[model samples]
Target: MATEKWVFMVTAQTPTNIAVIKYWGKRDEVRILPVNDSISVTLDPDHLCTVTTVAVSPAFDRDRMWLNGKEISLSGSRYQNCLREIRGRAGDVEDMEKGIKIRKKDWEKLNLHIASHNNFPTAAGLASSAAGFACLVFSLAKLMNVDEDPSHLSAIARQGSGSACRSLFGGFVKWTMGSKEDGSDSVAVQLADEKHWDDLVIIIAVVSSRQKETSSTSGMRESVETSLLLQHRAKEVVPKRILQMEEAIKNRDFASFTQLTCTDSNQFHAVCLDTSPPIFYMNDTSHRIISLVEKWNRSEGTPQVKF
Candidate 1:
């Protein structure tokens, strides 16, 4: 390592995603593999997104991170997994003007400083971790010049947070629950571009901005362990829904899309409640909104508006 006090940094912005076909449980928790294939639509980066900046410097003693300007521990396995995967693929980087050169071998020893912030609320069932982790890995890959495609990088992001793999793409994306032990085949694939269905509108209601009492990871674990609905949904329900959802998106079939999205969402919440001791992700206000949407749909004789 050089004695020069040179700092190299990279910043990236990644948007969160709304899972139409929800991913509620993990088959392999260690690798962050979901039990069922899920589909999501990435949101606009102009709002409700995460921006992360990663820096590498010889002066730093170890890998450290700050989330929303507050220092956070990187001791978690999720962070370690992402760091290990990206570092292993680090490439040589050189900047002539800065008189700095970092070989691929130096990445193992070089400490990184990461700072991330989310425009939307964190852990309020908003998939903030998805955007956060995707931004983290995406920014780091740019910093280290890791030679990998978005699909490959999505696999690394999946280890950080399951839904994060979907944020790697723009529009509609599918996270296939690969039939592999190592999770190499479990990757996010783009179903369509952002402009694929430009006419559709998405309305987000923020009933609560505070973090939920139960984390998604813990809730999923609890559900997988106890909820019979989760097992059935993962094995029977989700597979069919995923296929229908894909066709809906492809054909821009609003009726089918609305039906699939709303039902899958309801089923997901039901699975949450089916867990031992139960988990409630939606409050009264959320229920009211859903009820109102349902009433309007029932009166209109079709899904004129979907929640």
Candidate 2:
């Protein structure tokens, strides 16, 4: 009897997320754990998402991947970690008609071919990593029949990027900085769905998103090493701000939301200045945009910038 070659694949889409309460640092670098809790709004999946198709075939010899239709090296630690974790949880798969039988043990030996695409501009300041990892996990979960819920799967995505955990859900999400040393509890939870506050309109204007000279990772690391304000902001300010932000979200108070978001952004910038070399995430153009908004608000005599 002659055996036939088999190809089985699964595809999934996931949205990118923007943090209102930004994730500035990490307590556990290897686990991609954060120092302080962060909250984000999951953008519309239709507007921005990564579509990943994961396939396993008898003809494949080793694991291979493509990003945005171009072959990208999976040699990075992030890719390797995600692949290893997902593969460990692989379950049984079968196709009765094709007589294709993939036992639980076969997953270890069978190599994978993955192709991913992003709808939005990757070079833009948007959070591509968040969507990319979420899709990677989502697609793999379906392919392997992993029984874990979105929150459990978020923990897996977190290993790929610190901000990615929040993209597992829609609407407002909070990435709780779990206390466990093993980072088992560090996962995202939904605070409010998109329809919870229908009247609010959110606008994001990118003044000039030229690739930041210092990556957020290196910039935060420098801040942690030198900035005196960093200690107080993390230890004192963020704890109170988080509670207030939660209350604002719960009550749908746009006034409170505006104030807290603006203040926290300024405070973060101040901490950047307090760094020895001074890392500036926001440029002069950012200030100009803020000034224009402030002038417009004054002219209207009321907060017209709703959303």
The best candidate in terms of lDDT = 1
Candidate 1 lDDT over residue span 125-158, tens digit each: 8999999989999998999999999999999999
Stretches of model 2 off by over 4 angstroms after superposition = 1-3, 96-99
lDDT of each: 0.93, 0.83
lDDT of 2 at 20: 76
TM-score of predicted structure 1:
0.98
**TM-score (all chains, Cα) for each model:** 0.98, 0.92
Model 2 per-residue lDDT tens digits across residues 1-307:
1146878898888989877777787777789888889888788777778888999887888889998888988888998888888888878887777677787777788888999998866745678888999899888888887888889889999999888889999889999989999888999989999888777766666666566677766777887788878878888888888999999999988778877877887887898889889877776777888888788888988766622
Ten-residue region with minimum lDDT total, candidate 2: 201-210
- Global CA lDDT computed for model 2: 0.83
Q: What pairs collide in candidate 2?
A: 201-307
